[model samples]
Target: MLLADSPPPELQTLTRGQYDLVEYALAGAGFALLAYALYSWTSRSEVGVRYRPAVMLGLCVGAVAALSYLLLFLRWGAGYDLTDAGYVPTDQARLALSPRYVDWSVTVPLLTAELLAVCSLAGARARKLRASTMTAAFLMILTGHLGAQVVGEGRDTTALVLWGLVSTAFYGYLYVALIGAVRSSIPTIGREAAVSLRNAAIVLLATFGVYPLVYAVPVFVDVTAAWLTAIQLAYSAADVLAKVGFGVLVHKVAKLRTAEDVAAGVDTHPEAVWVSNVEHSRAVLPPAQPPAMATSPTTPTA
Candidate 1:
């Protein structure tokens, strides 16, 4: 097993390649999420009003996260002075984390909203669940940010740990509430929506699990170049999954639900019937149009 001796950033002797890994991770996440956000925005017309909130939340989360990553990438580039020997940290190094907090603060609340949007709740129940989870998500991110600030300021580790614990309580609430809501909603929804929503929950559980581990890194290990590289990579990848990946899955659930509704003869968006055709084909449901329509000769007019 490799042990981190915990060399401070200035003394770490970080090579250009190692430095590039961190920079590229931030930039890659930014661009990918921005693209996803645009895709979500354009796809708005494809889903019905019932599930549109889910898609909209995805767009908002992806957009905010993309901007945050852009800031992080630029901040990372500016924070390092590339010398022949290695990369050295500048005064701007600490500023990189600010964008990270900003990303979390906005995206976290929005994530819960999207999750609720796909659930099978309604009326006051829906409103109540949304409020509770969104509040928890916001507090979770806020306390986590405060804890990180405590750590960054070289304050008492006890206070840092305390904040971490408090943040963790909110995190636990968010995780449990999200998972519970998703699981409960699964049995009540259509087949395609259920599967995608279940998958989204699984992905949510996975990506949510990754964050605190990354957040806890500084507490246990020395943030050497290797550790920082790992942290950047882990956090960036997690953000992509939790934001972009989650968005895609949420959209898929909403899309499939729209398909089910349209298949059931409900009036919806103009493109909904075609979207249903495609999704129903994938789900092995009854074909919206006969296969003969594509290959067979046209029937004579009446």
Candidate 2:
């Protein structure tokens, strides 16, 4: 059935106008953040080559998130109703399939990797942690996107609730993994870097918790355009915290690690002090002692 054939909700035009205004403002902010992230990535020489990859990953997270928000703004500005086309009769298509989900699907895993990478985990352990963390993060976002799809389709409340629960479970697992990864790195990366990484992870997890709350509100209560606006705004704020803010935090951790390496002289010479000494003495031998003759003379005198 055509959307025009069905009765529309009592949408306040003024509310939509306000939403548009807010979206535009957010878009501008997103652009600015994106620019900053790119600049940071490009100017990574400030942190030195050792930290470039980790810092680049963080910058990528910010850039991707800002791009996502800008896409959402464009979607909202286009006036395309989310509930425009669906098979279910009661499923009035209101939730526009905003590109936010698309963005999340790509960026979320990268964000997880970024968090883990800045810790400078070594060899096989780093690979394992990155794999596990990225897997969990990908699952978390996948389930959440699926749940959003179900809700957008006007599915039964029970279905929506179940999806929400599943997504939440994935999120819980993801958070635990993130914390574990950060904590495990303390012995390797030092307490300062570990603490910084932990704080960034916590900030991300905390901000992400708000998404489910914002999503649940509309599912259980009467939803209006204003409420939709609130959801968008809340999500935007969370994105900034989780992505841009977290990126900055990750950068700080990388910077700290770089400084520590420089101070320890590891950046220039990675060999242990004893090993360095051995290498230095390779061309020289200890002077031979006339020990046997000295001992014999002393014994005779006694």
Which candidate should be chosen as best, given lDDT against the real structure? 1
Listed per candidate, the RMSD to the true structure in angstroms reads: 9.4, 12.7
Give the number of colliding residue pairs in candidate 2.
4
Global lDDT of each model?
0.77, 0.64
Stretches off by above 4 angstroms in model 2 are 1-17, 48-50, 80-97, 151-155, 187-194, 268-302
In model 1, where do residues sit more than 4 Å from their true spots?
Answer: 1-13, 151-155, 273-302
Error of 2 at 257 (Å): 0.3
TM-score on alpha carbons, each prediction: 0.85, 0.74
1-302: candidate 1 lDDT, tens digit per residue: 22244434433556888888888898899999999999999999777788898888899988888888878888888888888888877877767566777788888888889988978888998898889988888887788778666454523355557778888998888788888888789887787678889888788768878877876766665567776687788888988898888888888888777777666665444553344345352222334764563567879998
* lDDT, candidate 2, 1-302, per-residue tens: 11222222223232445456556657765876697588667757545466677677777776877777666665555544434231121222243334667777777788888777776566898888788777877777777767666454433455557777887887888788777877777778767667787789888789878878965663566555556556666767777777777877777777667656655656632322122123211122225666674343445553
